[model samples]
Target: MKKYLPLLLVVALVLTIPGLNLDQVSAESVDDLNKQIKDLEKEQLELKEKQDGLESEKSETEKKIQENLNKQGTVKGEIESIDQQLDTTRANIQAKENEIAETNKEIDSLNNKIKELKEQIEELKEEIKKLQEKIEKREELLKDRLRTIQKNGGQMRYIEVLLGSSSFADFISRTAAVNIMMDQDKAIMETLKEDRITVETKKTEVEDNKTEVEDKKVEVEDKKVALESQKQELVALQGQLNNQMAEKETLMAELEHEHEELHEIELTLAEEQEVIRAEAEAKKKAIAMAERKKTELAQLNKKEPAANSGNPNGIFTHPAKARISSHFGMRYHPIFHENRLHAGVDFATSTGTPLLAPADGVVSKVGVVGGFGNAIFISHYINGQSYTTVSAHLSSMSVSPGQEVSEGQVIGATGNTGNSTGPHLHFEVHIGGYGNPVNPLPYLK
Candidate 1:
């Protein structure tokens, strides 16, 4: 009977030990899972902070770019105005140059005409001198012929000799000789008269030539006066043209300078845009990584029992070292000039402060949001229930979407961002795609 009692006690002890060991294993696994979830939540909070920071930086860059564009537009308008002025000035200068050329041609023609008139006048003077010499020679010849006739007794003796001739043939011959002498005297007189008349005619022609030369000289003087006037006018016009050319040159130079400045500004803008694009791409990649991690955590949570999944009382740790500057609630916006609902809490902190995760979780979204600036969202599990936490208005981010993060891990810092009055972090708790915005104070310990 004693042997049978010992065997029964041994069997009972073996069954009890196995049951207790199974219970202990279950409890240990639940605790370990909870710890991991808290760590991941904290990591997610840190990533949210980093995303907020990036968004703030992007906003500032956009503002600066807009201002630069406005300035460039104004410069372009000024350049266009200058270009028009330059064109007008150039046209005026060209017209002036043509006028000057025409004036010079007119002066040259006038000078040539004056030279021809002078030559004509000189030829007329030489003709008048020749006529005067001929007249004087003819007058001397006439005086000599009259003196010979008087010395021959006026020729009455020759006529009587011819009339008293004894022979008829001698009388006839004497008569013929007398007649020839008379005819010769007549021819000499006629020649003298003709020479006198020629002299008178030549004198008259010389007077007419003198009168014409005087008129020509007067005309030449008038032409010279006119040319001088034209030359003076041309000089004045040339001066105006020179001034216009100088003005045009100045305008062109200014336009060129403006063009260069615009080009430089465009290059700067392009570089800035490239930098912004790279930063945005990096942020997007980070968000994707965070989402992947959230999906993995969700799968893990699904496999666990509800009681062993996560914190059931909604207790979460603070994500970073930051002071709350504004509480989540309805608030007045300065720019909008209206009361609006503030979806998150604002935390004031120094630039580049380290941000930490609030609980164990996975990063879900990380990127820029318009009003929130740079922002990040983390998905966390609490007793089989999933919740998302958002952080905004940060200067930079350090984590990516789908990345696993533990509690209190560094992810980003706090900063002032879009629609912000000061440096602070905006934090919020969301469930089911922002449909429910819960109080962060209730969830965070």
Candidate 2:
């Protein structure tokens, strides 16, 4: 009973909320509202009971759906999924409808029971009242008899009546008269006692029945509230399911478009990598051709690659002002839960945070390439080693392909775009080509 307090309070609040005017309620109106509420509650309870039965039906329906999926072709599987949803929804609605009927019948039964109990209680009360009155009358009569007997010397009167006989015939008649009076008083006294017990017994029985009825009424009211809430929820869910079926084609088209878009992005990335390979080949050819005139070029230009800065391994700096939220490794993804290589370290940064260039390099590609929303790929040939740094999931980019950038320069902004969960830099360092990746954390200053 104590556990029911919260539920009751919730019901009260829900019914009274949203600008309901308490002052507008008259006694009659309150009574009417109470009657309606009780009816709704009862209806709700019945629907809920029906819902329980529907759960079993739902389970069975789901099993049927699984069977369809297991045996059907791809196209049929989709159609079956929708059909299953419709079947489940229809089953739920039917259950609630049946519940409504059952509830109404049960409510009628409860009302009839309550009426009978009230009538029985009233009859008992009337009987008790009558018995009380009878007992009172009997009590008074008995007291009067006692008083009369007392005035005439009580037990002595009986003896006197028997002894004070004029003749033998008179003695016998007086003795009979005394005996009849005593017996009549004793019978009335006994009747009074019995009536008192009868009144008390009826009163006790009525109290017990009244208490039982009150408890039952409370139980019915609570069940009604819960059922009403459940029914409304189901109604709303049914509407949503109907809408899904109506817009099935639109949803299917959207999904197809997404897949096509992904394929295009992959093709674009492949094309860009091809362009890089072609450019690298061209450079290598030019260097080979220049080798023939190496002595003459050395005499003209006595310059080698720039030396490492005063700072230790000063080839790079942090790409953004952030801590490493995720480390690069073969691990399960947070969202997909698939074990895949996390190509780069994820620097947890706010959206719009500037992504600083870790080293002087030429930007190779910058565009909406794929899942890496707005990406920037930079290529560097330092100390005869070809290295590429790929920064992905950018909110915005400041550099373009073929653009040159120095260390600490802003190339892009961090973002939660492209297959990303939140705003963070997905930075990767690749050796040789984009295919080879090593941890970026080892290079960050």
Off by over 4 Å in 1: 1-145, 148-155, 210-214, 259-445
Superposed by TM-score, candidate 1 places the C-alpha of residue 353 at a distance from the truth, in angstroms, of 37
Poorest 10 consecutive residues by lDDT, candidate 2: 283-292
Count of steric clashes across candidates, in order: 34, 4
TM-score of each: 0.34, 0.42
Tens digits of per-residue lDDT for model 1, 1-445: 8655434433332333322343344555445444444444454465455446555655655665565556556656665665666566566656656665665565566556556655654664565466556546655766676676676666766767687888999999888987887787687678767766765675676567656656665665666566566656656665665666566556555555444444434443443333333333333333323333555445544442333223444445566566667787888744235796767666677767777776566666566655566766665555444456777777888887766566567888877765467777788876432325776766765
Give the whole-model CA lDDT for all candidates, comma-separated: 0.58, 0.66
Number of colliding residue pairs in model 2: 4
- Alpha-carbon shift of residue 93 in model 1 (angstroms): 12
Which residue pairs in model 2 clash with each other? 41-224, 42-224, 44-227, 44-228
lDDT of 2 by residue, 289-368 (tens): 23223354444234332242223433456788877899989986442347878789888899999998876666767877
| Most accurate candidate by TM-score | 2
Task: Give Cα distance to truth, residue 95, candidate 2, Å.
Answer: 5.7
Q: For residue 105, give model 2's deviation from the true position in Å.
A: 2.8
